[model samples]
Target chain A: MPEPLFLLSPGRSFSSVVSTMIGEHPQCYGLPELKIFSADTIGASWEKESRPGSWPMQGLKRTVAELQFGEQTDKTVDAAEAWIRERFDWSGRQMMDWFQEQVGDRILLDKSPANTENGANLGRIVKAFPRANFLLLLRHPRPRGKSQYSTISKVLDKNGIGGMGFEPDVEWKWTGTNIMARQLGQDLALGQFMHIKGEDLLREMDLYLPQICQWLGIRDDAEAIEAMRHPERSPYATLGPVKAQHGNNGKFLKGPALDFERLATMPEASRDGPLDWDETAEFTPQTRRLAHAFGYR
Target chain B: MTLVETRPAPAALATLPGPDKPVALVRFGDALYVGTAAPDPMGRGRIWRMPWPAGGAAEIVYEGADGSAVTDFAVFESQGTPVLYAATAALGGGLLLASRDGRGFGPVAPAGLGQSGNLWLGPLAIAGGRLVVAAGSAAPLDPEASGARLLASPDPESAVWTALAEPGFGDAENSAIAALLATGAGLVAATANPLRGFQLWQMDPGGGWTRRLTDGAARFSMNPAATALSAGEGELLIGTGAPARPEAEDAAGPAAPEVIALDDGGAWETLVGEPRFSPEGFKVPFALQAAGFGQRETACVTAILTGPGGALTVVVTAVTGATPGPFGQPGLGASRLWRSLDGGESFAEVPAPGPVLAALATPEGGVLAVAGDAGAALHLHALA
Candidate 1:
């Protein structure tokens, strides 16, 4: 059997795009984050539920909306959510079993970022599927923080959830989450695990895309290369209901180029900016010194 | 002289029934209870309890209905009645629950516990009729400066808890209070700090606490924190360390947290080091509990070892690993039974039928080992 590829990253680390690219390879099939492993227990109900509001389910919904609905409007997204609620009835394990069935003898790609938060659960996954490989996507602390705040805020706004009174400090959460994931991966000696930077993925997709495919034992052919070039073709591209206008002049469904300059100047609570690259980056001195010493850095 | 015949594999013991999210097990009377995390369907958490000797089936016992997870549990008997206490954290508050029936539990809200940051209550023990509870900060990612606090329940039946003393143990952040024992001297608490290492704290009845022994970076890795505490024959025994940390070229290998034997007034000494037969790199110790023997000085060690395959292997370690073999091999079967004739210096395999999940020495020298996944059966092994 082909080994499953697990993508480990914090929320909003370009996992959707990269995972889709890797899955597009002929030998691979990218999966929506089933998130089955995080449940305290492995059971039928946990797999069937569509946790729409959660980060894991949102990623899954986006993928379904883009693939099944093909529309980015609020009305279309809502319809897609209803569609999912009505149609899918499987637990995370069942979903994985289905994936295995669909891509018989082919490598499976799991793209859930939340799984990084759980060590015991992750350990269970590796134990259950010994051949699984992990691809850890890293992002610059400041920009990543900015992206997370924007994304979380947008989600809250769209769902009509009121904004938290406190300005979101993305740097703190991002750095903390990354540090945890890094420590867990190291502690487990996950031999199949590899780390990739989000900046590198976005700036040099052409070069790195094929490398990822090759690492997962997938053939990087022309069709796959073209598919990688057009990530909008990913099923998750336009998956959710578009949020109501909140003065922000950007489409929530579209993946926009990260504006590093604008992000750097954002308030500490906003983007957690001026993220002294050497300090905020995972395994950097700032994170290592300030955070609990996991001996990873 | 003729050699003694080896006993057959012991029959499977009763299994505990409930959600399989790793559990905290406590035995009171003929009943055993496993405390587990039952987060609300909406994502909050509550404590779920199920009868031990029953497979993993569960019924809600205490609802943090407010959004906290019931992280730890302790059970003790007051005047022949079983009283249960649980530590819970949710919605920015920490609380302890006390129960008379062990089923209908009520909150033991103390006047001023620490703020509702990540904290958990662990190991409930009764000595001299006082209910002693240990509280500590949750894990590394949660927060720091969270030391372990002791709450004394004057009346285990009353839902009132008073802070008796603080262990003053250095930041227990990212570690759990493995086990607590009431020694003739005072109280000894085993704590594992995943990053800083593991240490044993000695607390005097008068309210002074000091570090007894500090091992060099041996407890860090992924070893489970201490879980069981018991006293026998003037020696204190502690079961700790979870599955070993898997070996990596860049990562540290597993550190064998042990079931230690501490002298009457002296510090702790290692009785069982990390088991040599454990899966190559998995460091976490699976399960441990103390068993009582009639003579007080003779106690048995019942422990579960988790291997790379996620299989639970049970073994009985005596003073040394020299215990007679039972099943095909030691430490490889689902569970094996052993006896320690000379304290815990060596171990010999007993005729346990199948893999056992937990074992507690009985007052009669016969051992009671809990087996099956999640508490399925209770196996009784009688020793002559």
Candidate 2:
């Protein structure tokens, strides 16, 4: 088994498509966002913060059921649940080893941006796979801010959870998530991490992707590059099997076609919006510093 | 629309314990019922009832177990008697209902309930003698067929709850009933699924529910989501906002916040929230704002109430800072009050602390509003 390549990003950072595209490389296997780094032990999922039946555990069960059993059926789900029960106390490194073995020969690719919420969470991934290459994903603060709000806006419309509709609130939340991720990745060994802007990946996939392939030490040949083009062809591309319905991005699950053209039209990030979220609320010093470092104005 | 006078509240309202936010407020008979999000620790939600107009200490009427927000609420007549209905977040928090004549409050379990873990029951309405409710749930994760449900109790007074339409509406995960309206023509409901945009469904006079307005084959474009449903003189008014949720935003639809009007089952026309949801239309924050990026959030129609003879319509919209505004970077962030003088037509901003959570039309034609964030700041306005 080869060392895995991990994607570190905030929610809504287009990590899903990129990671899956990388996994679609003939020499790699895209592991579902195992989120194994969230806890010290696998059973930690069921007992996180003393709240049993957490989403992580549920998500993991679904993932294992689909990936290991090769299908998410009644029997396969039972098998997955039994498997978890059998290895309840396994450490994070142990679980990663098991997945790597299962993904034998193919380099394992894991990207669960949610795990990076706590900076220490990435340390678990680092210790577990010392040779892992960490790819940092970024998006413009402005468009990312609008996107972050879109995620919560319908929530009030659906369940009546209050206080999430504020535009500044939404933007700040986006800023914090991205900022934390960027700050956390700064300390990694230069060779172990690389930064990739979402817009660049989208508008110039042909340009950036080959460089990423070269960096991964994988074949940059036409055939290997062609394989990454059809992420939809991956077994787990379109929604995962029944039990493990998601191992990637929710939006990409709709079709999985990588259309760089659609992302090309995104207007340049602007403090001014038709929605008129406080224009004064432009990129703060912290976000501005990071955006500037990433080559944004 | 213009800003009107701001007056002190006729009386102070009790606050929910801790951060148990006030999620729903509705008028029931001679009393206004306030529903609060469940308190911490126990996660027990509460309902307080206060006598109308003449202010006094509110009485705690119901305490719900689970972290149920008591999100959807309605008090309507059942066989000429008042019946109360409430819904909560997520599956297993069963639909709650109580008849004024029945023994007491209890869970109303619809048949085949508890089928999905994602269904958090919300959106309630009374139309055509039927008590209607919409369940918020994601579509089945698999490609297998299923969706969020639109349910109707032909007699909410009875134990009968059935689907208004077939099982599937849109992609179950993204699809939800955003608003409901009971009109003389039919019981209308609006649905949003990022994939299909937004659609209008009507339970007709013949007891059959059918699709009314939709994008047809163009499932690729922006479908304005409808919320803030209200009654207008001889017409129905619907408020809209941009599709909420980053996952849904992949459609890149426009956030067009415009209030739409329907007259005698006629064409649905842009009423007050036009071109841009410029303050008066009681627009729900935003619908589809293509160019303006920063303002996609921050404001939403929190509540809609009516004055006597249904001549005056008031919408309470709130805007609060999550974090950015704290640094003195202010956008269109403020809880505001908007009014419609000619029954959901022209509008104006009124004097009041914004992000007005709820409002009730006083019998004297003034408006009693529950504004401010988390059930603070109560105020009353005399319509001039």
Candidate 3:
């Protein structure tokens, strides 16, 4: 089976769009946020992460529906869910194997942000798939924190996700995921895990995408690179069936096309400035150090 | 001078016996002598010589007991006869050995020059008609006396060593003098500093030591050491990188290995590093090749050997494969060798016979490189 590519990053790191873009490569099959590695077995992942209106399994549902049945719909998604439930004891590796068989020669990519929630989650992924390629997706802590706070704070406030005094501090998640991913990467081969600033990738896809392809030991020709530019062409780039409505970020589902204008005009964030989203928010020393390492000033 | 055709890659000469890592190499009287050590620092050290035109088998001239390894070699003219001197890092400390003929060798100075902490002696140079040796401790044999010290002896037989300056040239952070070169202007020394960066010092004929370059000639902490030095036509080329600790790359960001040149007029120019702004000035790579010869994972340029007819060879320590182990240990990788036919104008990659540990330029314009881990081999790059 082809070694899969995993985009390891926290939320709001452009991982969804970037993984979709990378998946649109001719030789790759980018799947939705299949948060299957959260548990050793698929059943545990389904049962443990269950919540009202929070259908985390939608990604895996839409993924199986599209790849296994060739189209994602109510009936196909239902069949896909049945197939997954039947293999309730299936390990992440087995599910990955089944996906690889469905994709055939193309490399499978999983960009589940939740996979980077903790070191244990990353350890689970590594233990199951030893030769998997990890892309250490990075974003400036400034922008990353802003997006994370604005998006997640509203949801937390309205839904009362944590049930009490749930502070919306994205600091730990952003820094923790990057640190965990880097620690895991250091143990792998030199080229096994790569780091690319999401801002850099968005600003200069022509310059970086081929470099990424070359690192993966894949075709970096004009045709392959051109295909990657159309991430919207991925089957899961849009909203899936109502039953499996979201396997990815909803905003991305609405406008899956690459927004070059917004990307080009994205405001630069300073390393030691007040965050625009939060009035009193200041990055800690650890966050600042990591930001500097990622070429952010 | 003969105009030679450009060749694609270097050719292997002979694979020697066990004790794989080749650390030091020098040319002596039509033969190339390579000093080999077991991969372990304290393992046995052996010197082997290969005949020129390099078809003959490499013969071991001298072998030290376990816990010793030859670190460097320099040839000096003694009373109208050439004598080869080898610096060995041994358990007892550093030893200076001299041999008039390749077959026989004897100690020139007492081990460690009477300082037991100087466990490693390297960067041997003949400066101002004196033998200069840079001595320091690679391991903490004696912490109090561990900093680098420059030892000079006017007469090898007498072995009366004189300190060029204080240990580490008066800076405790300058842990080792990584390289020494007798340039046209003066005797120059490059110190390896962990806290700051590599500092370049020069001693004029008047015996005045001046700090020529500081903060790795403006590269700052990235260049912890200037590992190799070669004298150019009216210029001195210094190769900079932190070679001591490659696995610590995660802790210390990647080393930007650079070959910088300092002219007689106190001017600096970058020969290999990419174009970047420095405190000194806007430095640009003089060579066509990218930084570290296009390998960002390259840790250091180990040797800069200049041969007859302006031929030069640059050997680099590179991380070839992945860092596979759980502790983030680096993967098995080979050092690289690049050749420059037009002085330091441009360079072309010579597919190394193996991971080149040390390389030396032959008098006949051929380059000899030592490579391998279990049992090493001698590779020859001929101008065909």
Candidate achieving the largest TM-score: 3
Which candidate model has the greater TM-score, 2 or 3? Answer: 3
Query: What DockQ would candidate 3 receive versus the native complex?
Result: 0.03
Model 3's CAPRI class is incorrect
Off by over 4 Å in 3: A1-297, B1-13, B53-55, B79-81, B139-146, B244-251, B307-311, B319-332, B341-345
TM-scores computed on chain B for all candidates: 0.61, 0.74, 0.86
User: What is the DockQ score, from 0 to 1, of model 2?
Assistant: 0.01
Error of 2 at A214 (Å): 55
What C-alpha lDDT do the candidate models reach, one value each? 0.49, 0.57, 0.75
Better of 2 and 3 by DockQ: 3
TM-score of each: 0.41, 0.47, 0.55
Per-residue CA lDDT of candidate 3, range A85-194, in tens? 99989988899999998889899999998798877778899998889898988788777887887777788778767446666677778777777776676567545676
Q: Report the lDDT tens digits of candidate 2 across residue range A1-297.
A: 677888877767777777888888988887666666777887774465222332335346655776798866657767887898789799877877777777678887778765676767777777777778877777776776667667666755566665654443655555566555544443444345666677766776666667677767788788888888778877667664454566566688887997656766755674333433455545554454344335443
* DockQ of all models, two decimals each: 0.02, 0.01, 0.03
**Number of clashes found in candidate 1:** 66
List the candidate 2 regions with Cα displacement exceeding 4 Å: A1-297, B1-3, B13-18, B38-42, B99-104, B110-118, B138-146, B155-158, B168-174, B215-224, B243-256, B272-298, B306-333, B343-345, B362-377, B382-384
How accurate locally is residue B200 in candidate 1, as Cα lDDT from 0 to 100? Answer: 69
Q: Over the full model, what C-alpha lDDT does candidate 1 score relative to the true structure?
A: 0.49
Candidate 2 chain A: 10-residue stretch with minimal lDDT: A49-58
